[model samples]
Target: AKIIHEELATALGPNTPSYQTVARWAKRFREGSEDVNDDFRSGRPVSVLTDENIELVRQVINNDPYSIYDDIIAETSLCRGTIEQIIHNYLKMKKVTSRWIPRQLNDEQKQERVRLCRENLAKFRDGFWRLCNIITDDETWIYHRQIHHKSTNKTWIGEGASPRTIVRRSKFEPKNLFSMFFKSNGPVLIHAVDNNETIDHDYYIENCLKPVVKEIWKQRKSNGTKDIKLLHDNSSPHRHPHVINYLTEEGINIMPHPPYSPDLAPCDYWLNDYIKQNLTDQPDKKSLARAISKLIKNIPEEEFKKTFDKLLERLELCINNHGDYFEHLIK
Candidate 1:
């Protein structure tokens, strides 16, 4: 304490640090700290956070981002605190939950995506009526437990006390498949497929596709419009001979959708995100469907318009990227 105080008095005449601050610095230096210079409580120790050590930590992390602090410490001569400070504060990096992509596309799939986007853009060059007329559908598995991001789970808790525990979800949690159909206006229907139901050609036509088409027809009839453009992935169930015949007979304009292109679908990119955000506490299948339905129905028309507008921007981005994934561009 006296040493730090004397140093402070010599440095700043009559504006020396208080006894408490001096005592703290003295204790820090006594605890094997090499530096006699005092820093803010949260500031790094100059002896450890050197430029060389920082570069070493960066190199080790670049080699393996998932490397733990202890591993990095073993690789370099840095202490755990210094490694963590370099990785988090200096590098501005964080561990985040991995998103689930539908499939890894090859070169051919990429070219197809680009071609489809360009063709669709040329087809609907003038206005958004084609987009508005488009009805998209997709099936997704709805789990009882929603994914909680690690970044979002942080809280202002008392020091030394852990955050409150949430109910641990199982890796093999109970889940059900749901087929959702939607237009530019809003959701048309969200159907929960029955348990033990095989989503094959016959099952899809009878249960999901047929019912969704009827609903769209009824809606268009009420609005004094007849033509409806359908958009769905090229799944086997969707491309079955009977399914094609049914759509053709019904006079629904089938929009071309490339396989493994969920990013182009509003249901996957927009509605699913909405449901995950609004219905974060889903406890059962029925409750989840109900919550999703309510949320979908409650979304404002302006929001739907904005979402549809984004399709154009995404399509243009896809074309510009030559059919590569363009999410990073938006971010």
Candidate 2:
């Protein structure tokens, strides 16, 4: 940019753009931004767009990213328009809500997560890529009738226009509890619990695992059942004595998952979210059920396999974090 500015100065002395202009355009091109427009005018005096006021607003924002605009104005003694212009125009920043995590882990739990991740990573050190040989499963609630999100219906409404009416059908919406099991190749089983059914030890073994074992037997006919490990969470019914006994009797090995660490699980990280993307904001119950059934019927092989690769990568990241929640670090 400096070299370009020198060239421009030599060719066109009076009409050449300033060095600042040349450098700013160079940066915009490098960052892949092509818009050739200034920030929208806020109708405030241009005097408030000074270096000192911008710096003050920046300092307050940096101290607390979650600080409201009013709070920033109070702290910096700046007017509303001045702050808005600084934040939206000069800083090129926007406020976003914090993301949710499964649990608020203490130091000990974080260390334990790191330890378990290290143990898992050691298994992959032999270059076998053991995730393909593992079967992952988890339970989630599937709503029968999904409500439309306000974000979906946003539009440019006139000030005096009548407000859009959205009738609420029921305060308590109907939903089904589903337990799903799948390997890297494809899904094995998705069992919808009976109405008002409590998932206990007996129901888990008889209703869930028994059918899952049958599918596993057919899937892994070449190797013994012990070769395929079961990766699951530390849920109550999952960790029950009868469930453990049932798995043992079938010669199915159990994969050790750290308690409260959903970030390390394949379904929690990828599969559940994959389903939610397609099923959210559905207004019809029967259509929602049909969509759910179709989705479970054909799990994408390529995308499903990618989840395993990402799983191994996440395990390494877990070790790097010393067992803290590391999903926020991804990408």
Candidate 3:
């Protein structure tokens, strides 16, 4: 009323009707007794969502964004109207779902990898090409596991149709085999035996290194060649003092293979995979051993010749590619 009186006094000069008269007019205006009146809104007014419901919607979206409105309602015990209202009004989150994909290696990692591979190649230059001059040896376990053929979705059409089940022909204990491949030749030696024990330092020296070295020495003597280099990974047995002393006395070059760098080893990178693929349809240990033994013994003379040739080729590729594949080593 005071504001209205002041406004009237200012607009109509110093003399104007007081606040009491304006107040009476304002009351009449509100009651619809006057020309001007205010009307209050009346209807089913919009409801505001609570903070708790908004948080619940966020949790649901985080867990599984593709969840349908009905699923959310069922899970959260929230009504469809409430979910929609919260999503649109309070949360304001968009439903854009996409599968998460990982990013690939960066440029710097690739270059560093290439560099290390080249360095390893430089160290072993010309040494790999010498005939039966170097033999790389390693051991792997062959478990008595069944090999499954690729399946096809076909049904047998017969009254007495029996669904196919894998057959267990025979059982064999876990076996360990020692394999050796000449750098200049293909796989030249393989030994598979049934020993119900783990290979330890003594077993490695007595069973693996001693026999192989003896054979290599014998071959060198027959060929009237000088001492040969024995290339092997740093398996605990190979690095034992006994094995080291023996190699040192024999005047054999023991090429140092970097730890955890199986990819650089020829036996790992080339021959092992080749052998495994060729010896397919393996069901049990006895058959697997036989197949492997046959494959190793009957490796064509030419395959051995190709071993060093392939190594050289790979080395050149590594040099040319700048060790991009060897980046895993740098890390």
Best by TM-score: 2
Clashing pairs in 1: none
User: lDDT of candidate 3?
Assistant: 0.65
Candidate 3 residue pairs in backbone clash: 113-326, 113-327, 114-322, 114-323, 114-324, 185-304, 186-304
**Better candidate by TM-score, 2 or 3:** 2
User: How many collisions between residues are there in candidate 3?
Assistant: 7
lDDT score for candidate 1 against the true structure: 0.80
For model 2, residues 53-88, the per-residue Cα lDDT tens digits are 889889998898889978997998888987888999
* lDDT (10s digit) by residue, model 3, range 1-331: 6788788999987578877888988778677675555456787566547787789887997898788998888888988988988888778876764533222335664565466556656666745535356678777665445243334324576888886665553545434564454556555467664456556777776676677667766666665224577778878878888888877776676765545545556777667766765565556667877787787767777876776556556655645655444423322
Error of 2 at 232 (Å): 1.0
- Model 2 — TM-score against the truth? 0.71
Clashes of each: 0, 0, 7
Where in model 2 is the C-alpha error above 4 Å? Answer: 1-64, 78-94, 127-129, 148-171, 280-290
> Which should have the higher lDDT, number 1 or number 3?
1
lDDT of 2: 0.83
By summed lDDT, which 10 consecutive residues of candidate 2 come out lowest? 280-289
lDDT of 2 at 35: 90
What's the lDDT for residue 207 in model 2?
92
